[model samples]
Target chain A: MALFSSLTPVFIAIICVLIGVILKKTNGEKEKRETKSKPLSRPWVDEDLKDGTDHHLEEEDVDEEWQGLDENVAHVPFFAERYSEGEMIKRSQMFYELLNKRRSVRFLSDEPVPREVIDNVIRTAGTSPSGAHTEPWTFVVVQDPYLKHKIREIVEEEEEINYKKRMGDRWVNDLKRLRTNWIKEYLDTAPYLILIFKQVYGWLPNGKKKTHYYNEISVSIACGILLAALQNAGLYTVTSTPLNCGPQLRVLLQRPANEKLLLLLPVGYPKKEATVPALTRKPLEDIMVVM
Target chain B: MALFSSLTPVFIAIICVLIGVILKKTNGEKEKRETKSKPLSRPWVDEDLKDGTDHHLEEEDVDEEWQGLDENVAHVPFFAERYSEGEMIKRSQMFYELLNKRRSVRFLSDEPVPREVIDNVIRTAGTSPSGAHTEPWTFVVVQDPYLKHKIREIVEEEEEINYKKRMGDRWVNDLKRLRTNWIKEYLDTAPYLILIFKQVYGWLPNGKKKTHYYNEISVSIACGILLAALQNAGLYTVTSTPLNCGPQLRVLLQRPANEKLLLLLPVGYPKKEATVPALTRKPLEDIMVVM
Candidate 1:
């Protein structure tokens, strides 16, 4: 009994040491999580990470089927239209004049646009070049009034949250100047609501994932062509990226998991009362540096 | 001396406990750092962060000069050209057919292109919409042979490293199929190289940074318009994004720190022997979902 008492202090010290170790471990994990959860302060580092072209490293291996075809695909002769310098200058000027007239019209007319024009515009968009020719865009055209209203609901709900909470005062102020708010009346008023989706990854025939490299950039480029096509057809749309509403809109549109909403365009003619902000583009000298 | 001997075991035990606590603290810090350094495994989280539209939260407040304009800009009546339905369909179809012929031609001829055409196309691109109408694109046209060669050198060096080290086997294989390698002969051979940079943020009059929201996507959309204008003017270019070479190229070009290279296009006529991958685009039904 005397020996037991003597050893008690040593035993107690051992238990104390173990308790300290356990507490340290728990605190370490908690601190680690806190560090990660904190918004990254280094913008440059985050910007580098968001390069968007590093999907090859981010994804698993795709199937050999399509890739093998890439190896064997024949290279065909490409012949482009050749025009004289005068003709080239004239065509470019005319095209520029045509495109310059395009404005993001918010007050859309409910007049029905020919469906053929929408299809043709989308087809033109599909011709856009992609990373390694991986066409990773899907255009969802909603003409039904009910579905458009539902989309408006999803978009407005999220946008309201964005305006009320997520968006700062400057952003709200900027939007206010643009005459834009969370309430998007054009969603229902436009004849068609084109929701563009970028497939981040594709599922292979074997159920494996195929990474779409530079998909966002590629899809945005396609949208640019789509805008041009719409202009050519005398159509107008206000390009919108509904913040924090991608997942809900994707599910509402019945799109698959790999698809992500990139841009939403309400396509139609502008109402007679439609007005746009009197904006001027920067002169060529301001935007271009010739070396 | 007798009392000191009796307390020796207890003192040793107390020292051991102190050592344990110190060791645990050190280990905890090391583990916390390790957790922070690990590549984030959650993609959806990363994807959310990559939403280019979230710059308002990411940047500091800008001086209120231009933003003030956004608030008070006059809403003028926007009059658009209204075409008959048949003419609209025809125009849209014609535009599609024209864009459909556009291919990513790798073998570009050294034929000099009209500078006026390039200017007009850039003007057209400037007309494209942006987030809060902040035109965040810089089109750097390199006509000097020496500078183009320097750009090519920088691109090739980084590309070689990417091919060998950063890119995995599958990516290498994918590019192999596309017949693209680190040796970018077109950079030197093409008459002009248009390097597109997205000004991540603009400098306000007060020297504070003005955040360009959705800069990457907006610049890309402008690029789309640029591509359309190029096609209209009978110019050919292969859109290329030189990975890991943006910083070096930016330094060589003497662009400001705010500008980051988004895409580099080698612009000219296609080589008579220019061949593109014999690829077919998915049909309209495949790409478009109509509701």
Candidate 2:
């Protein structure tokens, strides 16, 4: 009789466990269906996953990607001198005025500029922020007359076709007021042409391809800074994007196939009689919206 | 006999002119054939098209594109106080040093920031250069908790799939050192989220679509400037790009189809116990090549 009583209790315990498992699985499936239907719900909250406390900071053994690279980092004490609000406003205004005075110049003088100036300007450009610090850019300084002559020839050939046939009527009409033609004398006359090439991918020492993220955006930021640097040095430049520059220039410059030409900037002094079309930028109010 | 002699001279002159025209046409055809074969040769040059002389500046009646727009331009007297070369160098160095100290912060505090500060920072971003001065960008500031919660949930949902399935092994391997996972609590915790939307095309008042040029590059430059402005104001922000953020965020923010989401920045003060991955930027020589 005692043995039978014990057997009965064991059977009841097994049934209770089975019932709990079935209930838990049914709840899980229901929650999944709800999540699929309404994605913007607070269904996926795990209190343990939150890094809200100071405990995460105490974990010094965390494996970060940089830790695997074993790259050396230099620490330097930084102390930025605080400026009065008035001084800050004054400096901001000054920078705005300086940038506003910048204009695209077509009439260039063949006056020679020091190589050191170009070097400094490029260094300033290098300071631009990039995605993941993958600075995928190379600035090639072309000053040789022969190379410039060759580039000009190719650019003009393409531009001639662009103006005559490739460009639609509306495009041509829009450019009429700018008075730009296929013949680019400035390309030949400028003292320097900074050819910015963007590296789409990189090769490791073992020949594995390294993918670059935001290469176009990163290079464009550098180009903007380059313009500012050149202007600050009392030099003028025009942002030229010659169609079909990638294939021809790559061959001429002996650059690898991985790099693509981004910008061709003809940099030099403006001719004494240099004139730009009387153009005005949209007012600040039109461009900016306050919400 | 005198009349016959005069007519004969006139006939001789006409014959000489015809022969000259024929010879010029033959030479032009030959040059075109040569250009087709050897495009690097300088086959195009028009002395009249060159703007080297100062005479073009004297013409006031030249029709400019802006002349047709009839937009009122405010001509503010701009007289930037010139700094000595030494002072200029000092200022540039200081600015560079300040920027170098900026690091991407992940842990954010929900400390309330003044609206005026955000306004100034956005104004600074508006000053960035754009393609043809089109200024094709819109910055939408979101401070509503409900909207942030929705964005966070969507981002985390996609990120979870990305970490588990969508992203390849190599990409996940790369992200390991960063110690990041699908959980992004900063989106909800940060006081303000600046959603930068890039205008792919604009709708005119009459509902006609206006094409934008270099829209991607222009918006990227503005984003860089925005980051700098935020840093300059002693605020912290992370350049967060939640994958598949376009369609969902567009619906949540009520943005138009023509505008695409470029960046989603979470801005606020860093948490007291915030810690970042120990990473180092590539040195100048690694990033820049002067040729």
Best candidate, TM-score-wise? 1
Window of ten residues with lowest summed lDDT in model 1 chain B: B39-48
Best candidate, lDDT: 1
Clashing pairs in 2: A64-B177, A65-B177, A65-B178
Clash pairs detected, candidate 1: none
lDDT of 2 by residue, A1-291 (tens): 646544544555455445545555565575465334321111111111111111123222222222122233332333333444555455445555555666677888898877667766676667665555567788888898988899899889978877786554434554565566788998899989888877765554554555444566677777876776665566777776665556688678877765777778899878876777666665555544433
Candidate 2 has a TM-score of 0.66
Residues B1-291 of candidate 1 have per-residue lDDT tens digits of: 657756866787778778877877787677655544322222112222232323433453344334443467888999999999999999999999999989888899898888998899889999888887889999999999999999989999988987887665666776776788899989999999999988877775556667577787899999999999999999999998887787788889999877888899999999999998878988999899999
- For model 1, state the Cα shift of residue A236 in Å: 0.3
Across A17-103, the per-residue lDDT of candidate 1 in tens digits comes to 777777777877876765543222222122212323233333423443344335777878887889999999999999999998999
On a 0 to 100 scale, what is the lDDT of residue B163 in model 2?
73
Docking class of 2: incorrect
Model 2, span B87-161: residue lDDT tens: 545555555555566666778889876665666666666766664455778887888898889989988997887
